[model samples]
Target: MKALDYTILTLVIIGAINWGLIGFLQFDLVRVLFGDMSILSRIVYALIGISGLYAISYFGRIGKAME
Candidate 1:
C-alpha cells in the first residue's frame, strides 16, 4: 500500500512538472518522449489522470491531521 501511494504520488508530480513546462516553455516532455498521442503516451496520460483523481484522497488525510 505504501508503495502504491508512492508510485501514484510520483506520477502526479511528474504530471505537474510536465504541465509546468508546457505552461512556461510550451514544451511537452511526455509527448516528446513517448510520441504525440501514441499508445504509450495515451497510457501515460491515462495513468496520470487516474493518479490525479486518486490524489483527491490525500486531502482526506490532511483534514484528519488538522484535527
Candidate 2:
C-alpha cells in the first residue's frame, strides 16, 4: 500500500513537471521520448490524467485540516 502511494506520487510529480515544461518551454517530453501520439505516450497521458483526478481528492482533506 505504501509502495502504491509512493508510485502514484512519483507519477503525479512527473506529470506536473512535464506540464510545467510544456507551459514554460512548449515542450512535450512524453511525446518526444515515446513518439508523437504513440500508444505508449497515450497510455502515459491517460495515467497522468487519472493521477491528477485522484490527487484532487486530497485537496479536500487539506482544506479540512486547515479548518
Give the Cα error of residue 12 in candidate 2, in Å. 0.8
Candidate 2 lDDT trough over 10 residues, lowest sum:
1-10
Q: How many clashes does each candidate structure show, in the order listed? A: 0, 0
Report the number of the highest-lDDT candidate.
1
Give all candidate RMSDs, comma-separated: 1.0, 2.1
Off by over 4 Å in 1: none
**For each candidate, what TM-score against the reference?**
0.92, 0.80
- Residue 46 of model 1, lDDT score: 99
lDDT of each: 0.97, 0.88
